[model samples]
Target: MEFLARATGVVGGAVARLRRIGTPARQAIGANPQIPQARPQGIMTLKMPVAQGWTDGRLPICAPGLRVAAFAADLDHPRWIEVLPNGDVLVAESKERPAPPRTLMDRAAQATMRRVKAIGDSANRVTLLRDADGDGVAEIRTVFVQDQNQPFGMALIGDRFFLGNTDGIVAFRYEAGATSLAGQGQGLIGFKPHGHWTRSLIASPDGARLYAGVGSLTNIADQGMEAEEGRAAIWELDIATGKARIFASGLRNAVGMAWEPVRGTLWTVVNERDGLGDETPPDYLTQVRDGGFYGWPYSYWGKVVDDRVAQDPALVARAITPDYALGGHTASLGLCWMPAGTLPGFGDGMVIGQHGSWNRARLSGYKLIFVPFADGAPSGPPRDILTGFLSDDERIAYGRPVGVAIGPDRRSLLMADDVGDVIWRVSGA
Candidate 1:
């Protein structure tokens, strides 16, 4: 079996490379990314970069006029970040719980994960970092909350702190300057876990409700729609009443949610369905409507039907088009609104942490990006905030950026590098 698995992976990689030689060049990105014809391969592309962490004073290269340094290091898979009112930084240290392999494809996936250093027992904790002297680096590091089930998104509403665990949303009592959460927490709502298990949470401006992003169970409902029930959509949970409803449906995997500062509209960065070739459907950033639907299994990018899945013509008709495309298979995740002047030379925009691609012949995203916004939407092309996460040959990744947020000082940008186990701080040069 070991010999067979090795042979299969070698053959699959060779086949994927051969197919990519004839694939069309990718089209424009950002505001109007071109969607190409689907050419699903018999063997999916699997070119993952090996996770080789940073060493010997190595650092990610930032865009001109910007500088970056490690704010905090030696973390355990730091994936999400939240800034507290008292200027304390909360880092969610967790990863996906490994599922046992059941098939050849499953076995191959597990192997790939190991190479990329993705398979591991999750830390299941959130740590607090404090830079008491207002310096760029953190001097204090301590576990803030622990023994949770893959906690990701976090938001503090008044005296209650809500955490989006893989299975549901849990709320704990919070004190203004406390470092650790005292109780086990109360489960507010439950969600079907595992498949795309990162539940991202964001509170409404008025703090009346919390919106959680729940992803689809399979790539394109391959496990049947029954398993995808109450998923592939963002749910609105009323804080006082504890009632939740589908805010919007057919989102596939909406990971990051933030309000447009100018227009006060809710926006999200979604990870579209995969296995439709590399560039068939682009991941996007768009204004999320209260009761809108973006195509997932049935369609993509506004009624561009994905013939691989069962179709629904009525639902396809109402599928709303996204505002901007990040690129195909970019796995665009972390998103936060950047107010004007937060970083020098950049105006108000959205900062994205593209975790990079695993199932594409050519890599797409492994850096931090800033999309300029005007009025209320994306106005200009994306600017590279930080790069050089990948090596010269693109075979080794020193880091993969995830959650992005402004630092407590309101002048620095903080990003989580899960592969490197470092929280990087970016500031003006």
Candidate 2:
């Protein structure tokens, strides 16, 4: 079971990498007038290509390019990460506000909006990075808004930067050359926030479409499924037109997205349903089809049903479970693909931050894994690369990582640590 578990984790990781890796670096945006892929309404399947040099199951123990660094603020919840054209960073500090009053069952339902503020202040903050001199590292920058409330995810589109908060979206004129938010921003939407309130955003290569994640409205409730319960899915919006619609559903929580143009798919790393036993519901990584569903408050992993919502009548047949699944409740987040690397095993691979385990008695996660891809899709299984971040000796970890960006350097990597108040950098040494 352990080997099989690892195998599925590896495959799911790779498939996730294949689905969501998007960039115009490999090729220019000629705007192929292509329609969305035709997939069954509620079917979930793992897609990948045949393997070659990446067949053997081996990955770097330390993930080759990882180096931890400190941040300016005493960050309690550094939620989102974005890289600018210049050698700087934009990080959203989701304040760890005091827990709102709630009953036991309602505790798990808490979200970003429920809390008043996160860090010390009641307002959420946005901190920028500035190297000042050519020091190869960001030395200092300014905090754009020190009095904002719970800023979550954001994307850089042209001269304007779009950000997501607990309530809605905002835009700021970003001047990369001067390291500043140059102009006044406006609110885009006024959507209500919930427990799964981490709003990660994705924009088209041409910056036409904006994709954001809205987590489930309940902690696993059918009674709460009054049209809004599991609306915690991916939303597609025309940035120019402001038209928004649900792109996919059945995902309990998906805070990360990557686009794989080779196969033309959007993949996500999902934080699946909790409250099951230590190993009941497995987290997953798979291509999200348009209008696809993945069985929230009902089933999981395509077959293994969750007992929490077993008796609920609404969970009859609509919950489309996932394709490739990972270990139960690993809280998988940030997803990225390693373009063919200098190392033999890392050629065309994927890496996911296993954001550590919370419910399990015997702690799992607290590391990153590598998944191999072939023909621009996932091929073989995943293997542990950045392990030991959590101390198995005492089941203690100093950091919990969230956002991951390829970095300002073309070949470098960056990881945002919410618990450690730091943004780490990595590259091939």
Candidate 3:
């Protein structure tokens, strides 16, 4: 078995290298990306960097005039972050739940996941980080909530706290400065577990509703549409009545969501479907409309049909084009609004954490980026905020940024580096 695994890795690595020989740098980026026609391949491209953690206090390189430091360290796979009213930061520490391998592709994917340190038993907990002295580093670290089913998103509304577990939203009674949750939580909304399992939650501006992102159970609904009935869409849950309804549909993997303050519109960064060519159907950042559809299986990029899926003409016609493309296979996930003046030389914009990609021969999105906003829309090309997560040869990853949030100070930025097991803080130098 060991010899076979080694042989598979050698073959896969060689194939990946050969595919990268003439691959051009990514072109599908910015507000008007040149999206190429899809070229489906019988064998999907698979390339992932081996995970090697940071050493000797080395940190990610920040953009000029900005500096980064470890705000909190030594946590288990922290995937998402939330800041409380009292300046406490909450980190949701969890990982993907490994599924049993049933096919050759599945077995290969599992092996790749293990090689990249991407698959493991979830820690199933949320930890609190407190910066009591107003320094960038967190002085207090404690487990706030435990035994969760892969909790990823958290929201505090009034005295009630809500968590987005893999299976549902759970509510708990919260105190302003409490270190840990005291009682059992009540499940508010139930959802199908696993298969793009990170449930990202954000509170409505009015605080009467909560929006949760539930990803599809299978890529392109290959498991059939019935299995995807309530997946691949954001659900709006009424806090008072616990009634939930689908807010928007056809978002393949809308992981990060925030409100664009200028226009009062909700925005999200979505991870597009795979199996198409490296540059096909670029992942996007868009203003999410209340009942709008943005094609998933039927079409992509506003009615551009994907012949792989069973067609639905009516649905395709209604598909909305995303506002901006963040490059293909970038895995743009974490998103947070940064008001003007939060970071030096950076005006009001959205910050995205691209967790990097594995489905492409040449890598894309292994860094933190910022997209400037004007009149509540993306105004310019993305700017690299932090980089150097990958090694010079691109064979090893030092870290992968996941969830981003504004620090409680409202000046610094906090990012969850799942692979590095650290919460990084970025501030003006």
Candidate 4:
């Protein structure tokens, strides 16, 4: 099986290169993308080669009549963003922390991942950016929280601030207009070590509850289902108490989530499992329902079984289909729902940051887009809001956008570009 998988990947890579030529640059997008049939898991899947491709004095190209500028530069691998009520932007400058290799395969996989821009030392800190003069660029930059473990998500409610670390969730006492945190944070819960280390977090609208997204330990539960306990799901934690419970299950990796303003529904962008050809089950953006099972290793796209894992008839019976597909291997991670009139021509819709792909031969994503919404659901096809993250050669990437949030001005969009180490602000021309 291993030999067959390797041979298949070699042939597939050749086909992928051919398809890359003359094909529309942004073809792998839309509501229901064309998904390839599931194939046998590959032994050594195609790993994209990363290059330091950013040039000095260069900026990304934006949509017509839109402008993109570096709001804050020289950031340390910023991955997430949040705007405080006081109009300050909090950026989570984080990177993945790989675990000690347990086997030769583990070591090999880690090394390959490094070539594709996955491995990095966690900054373990959050920084605050203030544009006191109402300018697009931040004039005041300070470390908001420091000395932590792979922190990714952050939330603030009154005097309390919550942060989601790779291993656990913690809270700290926050003071209005404060620049930095000097005291210890109280731990709420710890997660399983290793695999899909990013833990995204958000607070409820009323501040009564908090939600944290924890990804699966391995693709397709290769480490055994027992290892998946308390993983691959979203947890709803009561802010008053340190208690949390599974809010939704069967999500492979719900990286980014938000609450719809009209219906108050929770939506997320999930990164699905890989090794199944260039496209099989597309990653999706869906409205998450309580106790919903959106299929993981057992099935995909609602009851379409993945033969890779042991099939449980009963589990597959309850799998729910996602609301919208963001294309296979797009790695759509950053999600933010904007209300009507947040920006001109962009009505109520969700802005998603497609973090690009390393598993496929021809890359997809690498841009920020908006999915128009109406009647509390995704209504129209995705429209490009920001482009030009990758060079025309397609072999080198200038930046990979990871997070998107409405700026304090409520008229501009803020995005975190991890590769370029800059926070960009976008506004209408």
Top lDDT model: 3
Can you write out model 3's per-residue Cα lDDT over 1-429, one digit (the tens) per residue? 334445556766777677676554656988778887787868777778888979877789999999999999999998999999999999999999865766787777777787677878889999999999998999999999999899999999999999999999999999899999975599898999878999999999999999999999877988899999999999999998889999999999999999998889999999999988777878899999999999987988888999999999999999999999998889999999999999999999999999998877778899999999999899999999999999988888999999999999999999999999999999999
Candidate 3, 426: how far from true, in Å? 0.4
In model 4, the worst 10-residue window by lDDT is 20-29
Report the candidate with higher TM-score, 3 versus 4: 3
TM-score of each model, paired residue for residue:
0.97, 0.75, 0.97, 0.92
Residue-level lDDT tens digits of model 4 in 315-423 = 8999998989887688898999877676777888999999887666567789999999888988888989988887776657788889999999899999999888899
lDDT of 2 by residue, 130-178 (tens): 6557444677867765555577777888877888776677887766675
lDDT of 3 at 383: 98
- What Cα-based lDDT does every candidate model obtain? 0.89, 0.60, 0.90, 0.83
Ranking by lDDT: 3, 1, 4, 2
Worst 10 residues of 1 by lDDT: 1-10
Model 3: which residue pairs collide?
A: none
Q: What residue runs in model 4 are displaced by over 4 Å at the alpha carbon?
A: 1-33, 102-105
Q: Point out the higher-scoring one by TM-score: 2 or 3.
A: 3
lDDT tens per residue, model 1, 1-429? 445445555776776678678565864377777788888766677777778889988999988889999999999999999999999999999988755666677678767776677766899999999999998999998889999999999999999999999999999999998989987799999998887889999999999999999999778998888889999999999999999999999999999999997899999999987777777688899999999999887999989998888888999999999999988888889999999898999999999999998667777899999999999999988999999999976788999999999999999899999999999999999
